[model samples]
Target: MQATFLIYSFLYLIVLIFLLPFEYFKRPASLRKRWIREKFGFFKKNEQIETFKPKIWIHAVSVGEVVAVSRLIKELSSKCEIILSTITDTGQKIANDRFKNYNVKVIYIPFDIPFAINKALKHFKPLAVILTETELWPNLIRIASKKMPVILVNGRMSDKSFNGYSKIKFFMKPLLKRLTLLCVQEEQYKERFFNLGAEEQKIHITGNMKFDIELREIHFPWENAIAQPVILAGSTHEPEEEIILDAFLKLNITGSLIIAPRHPERFQAVETLIKRKISESSREISFSKLTEMPSAFSFKSSTSVVLVDQMGILGSLYRICDIAIIGGSFIAHGGQNPLEPAYWRKPIICGPFMYNFPFIEEFLNHEACIMIDKASLLEILKELAENSELRQTIGNRAYQLFLNKSGATEKTLRLIEKVIP
Candidate 1:
């Protein structure tokens, strides 16, 4: 096993080196620098010479995971010194902004090479390693297991992931057994882990921490910004904007529309597409980014489509929407997040390809939300626009379900304590 992981690490290093040229040119400056520094275990000045008492290293890959572990990090920080690490620049930016006041030391997680992991382990001196959902790196976990507990928090394995893991049972068994603990999202996920060779004693079902979502749209002036019923194509993907824009023109729904593309890099592309589509509409369609609008927003009565070209604002934007069409589900990217709209107690609609979030099945099964193909999306939007009572019932049902599933953070904290304590 040791020999295999070493060879794996060597091959991985080579592959990264090979891809570096392309990545360096293509990615953002901050991201490229962060990736390079993290690849070689470069630590900042403050990261060096920290307090020596039992440090808990919390690793969340990006924004979603970083945000999910907020309550967990907050609760655990008081108990033990915290060292938070992320893989992406956006995640790093968000982590720094969110936890800037907190005493937690935030840094980038090194690439999964043995030497890089060794350097991180030496500097941080974490008493325990708490990994967020589905981040099972072989070399890092294998090395850390020797010095301290390597626990998996908010662990979940989707069917697509399970099938891939099952094929590599030989490599996975040893990796699974090294985990000091496993806090999974659902009971069914336990069986999937076992099939992938996790020890039964190590696994515990703890639901999703996302359900315990602690965000406030309390400040967003919905009444001022939203003149009429609005349809928000929140977190949309490539070509999704065109389809939804077509639907909006046809419906002539006499309301505002906001399309927030999933990636910031695509904001210009979406903006251009929306501008072209607005040419076909007889009703004057106004287009603007969130930043372009006035602070004391008074939305225009004429048909308007606002392209949300910013970050950390989408969750708050949900409060202003009458209906939400989640992105990524329409394409093979799986889905962005239907849960955000649900958090705002708004009626949500998504596409058929939501394999990325199978946990949402129970919510969809109970008809708390609607999932339709891209072709049928217009029909449902039209129906929901007309039927006030139906929209209220569906939104209320999803909201109730979201409230009921709120204790995962508490459950996860209890289990995590058993290891770090």
Candidate 2:
């Protein structure tokens, strides 16, 4: 078993080295330096650590996972020092900026190699390591398990991932065995992991921690800045923006619309798309990016749509908007978080492809959110706009579900304390 593992590790290392130049050069200049630093595990934050001291290590790969685990980290911060690591630049930025208020040491996690993992483990001698959602690193799990319990929190195994792992089930057994426990989102996900060589006894269904998110009341400047109710289409992908524009045009009500694309790189692309849509229409309308003005800023009489090109303000926008059209759902990208809008008592319109968000089913069934064909988006928007009471009914149902599902984070905390406390 050890021999086979070593062979696989060596091959993985070869692939990593082969792709180094391609990956390194592709990053923008601002992030290239950080990439270089992470490659050597030379993060400035770990410089002060000279010896083995007990801390908690939480690894989240990107913005979505990072946001999902925000409340978990907050509750755990008071109990122990935390070393948070993220793979993407945007996730790293949020980790550093948001977690600075707590006992968190944010750093970019190095690639999954023995040397890099060893360096990170040496600096922060954690009592336990918590990996968030589908972050199954073979070497890191195996090595860390030998020192302390390594738990997979809010674990999920999609059908696509399960099929991939089942093909390599023989080699995956050793890796799965190393994990102390699997706290999964649902029973189906736990069963999927078990079928993929995970020990049935080691997996527990803890539900999704994202449902237990702490919703903060943020006063958005745009909320008071505009004269009419705002419709926000947040975390949108490619053609989703165009769909939103077409639907808003169908709405008989007069209100400002904000479209925030999911990827930072697509901000310019969405802006261009929106401008073209505005110009093609016969009616005169105004447009601007959210970064252009403050809360006190007023829109021109003809101003209608605004593009939120900036990051870290989506939550605030959710608090202010009357209706939310979550991005990624309208396309094949699964779905973005519906809980964000639900927390603010706002009705949501999601696309049919919501496989990524298994939890949204309850909201849909309870009439907290509505899912329609992209073609029917116009009809739904028009109906909701005409009947204020129908919109309120959807929002109320979703908010009630959000309240009922508020205990996942607390449940996860108990499991963590059981292992590490």
Candidate 3:
């Protein structure tokens, strides 16, 4: 079964290489590493660390996972030498920037081929391997388990993902059993993993690592200068921006509307949408020009919208928002993280697609957050904007919920210590 799975994995990689266009291959270095696997070797020569002895290796796939485990990384650094690996360039960038001061090495995870997995293991020789979220690379898990302990931290299994894996349960069962522990984010995820042949004794509910992120004070350039209520539409996707703009026009509130698209590549597209919606009387503000305006003028004028075209600023930008409309929920894209806004004590408004984050739904239920389905967004926005008392009440409740869930980082770090040699 393992041999057949390995053959199928190779075929899948071949299909991906052929189907994806050359231009779409944005990360040349990653592609090069994969191609090296097809030729003389699986892992790149440079990926091998000769002298660095890592106590633990943590794999975080992308930006969300990187942010989720960042606090845990800091806490675990005291006891172990941490090696962080990510598949995406954005994740690598975030990890490098965040862990620059610490004794951490960030590397790109090689392809999941057997040779690549073996090579990575032989070089790092980590005491244990920890994977964040739903990163289940079969070969990596199998090979790493042979030499050292392997665990999944902040593990979660969506119903859709679970169903997909169940089809290959014959191959998946052994892969799962090799894990030393499965630190799950929620009880439902824990139960689902167990149903899919995961050992019950290996699973534990550690809560979402995102809740573990500490809220830092962000000093917005307009913090003291602006009194106008700022409405932040964060991590928004296509079509949703149109809905938000229409709702914003209806409210006609005396404030700035900041739209931060989920992907940096969508900046120009979102900017175009905002330009089309804004009236000729209103001016759009850019972050670059934020310093030119006078203290009073920053809040006084009819600057209708601000487009956040850069990365690494959305979380900090949330500090200035009076109300937050989290994107990705409007359409059926499952939702983006809402905890950032909740941490900042801002009342959150999201669309109805939130299955990816069940804990967030629980938080919203307890806090009485403003939830608007795709159809009723306009009405919800108008009501929230008009009623100051209602918005503040919900905002305060959201912050209180954050305060209650503050210790997940400490809890997760303690678990890491138990596993590390």
Candidate 2 Cα deviation (angstroms), residue 354: 0.6
Clashing pairs in 1: none
Model 1, 314-343: lDDT tens digits are: 877888788989888888888876778888
Q: Against the true structure, candidate 3 has what lDDT?
A: 0.76
**Per-residue lDDT over 1-421 for candidate 3, one digit per residue giving the tens place of the 0 to 100 score:** 6686768688868985774455245555655555444222244466554554456889999888989998888877666678788876667777888889886878777667676667667666688899988999887788888888888988999888999998988877878899988888889999888988899988888888888775567676556554357788998988988888777776666666778888776777877777667643254433322334444445445445777776666788888888899889988888888988888878899888877888777666786576778678778777777787887888888888777766766766677667766
Worst 10 residues of 1 by lDDT: 218-227
lDDT minimum window of 10 residues, candidate 2 = 45-54
- For candidate 3, give the lDDT of residue 362: 66
Candidate 3 root-mean-square deviation in Å: 3.4
Looking at model 1, residue 363 earns an lDDT score of 81
Residue 123 error, candidate 2, Å: 2.0
* Model 1 residue 302 lDDT score: 59
Candidate 1 contains a number of clashing pairs equal to 0
Cα RMSD (angstroms) for every candidate in the order listed: 1.8, 2.0, 3.4
Candidate 1: residue 293 lDDT (0-100): 71
Query: Which is the leading candidate under TM-score?
Result: 1
Residue-by-residue lDDT tens digits, candidate 2, 71-147: 99988887777888888778887777778788888777778878888887876778888999899988788889999
Give candidate 3 regions above 4 Å deviation: 19-24, 28-53, 225-227, 279-300
What TM-score against the true fold does each predicted structure earn? 0.95, 0.94, 0.89
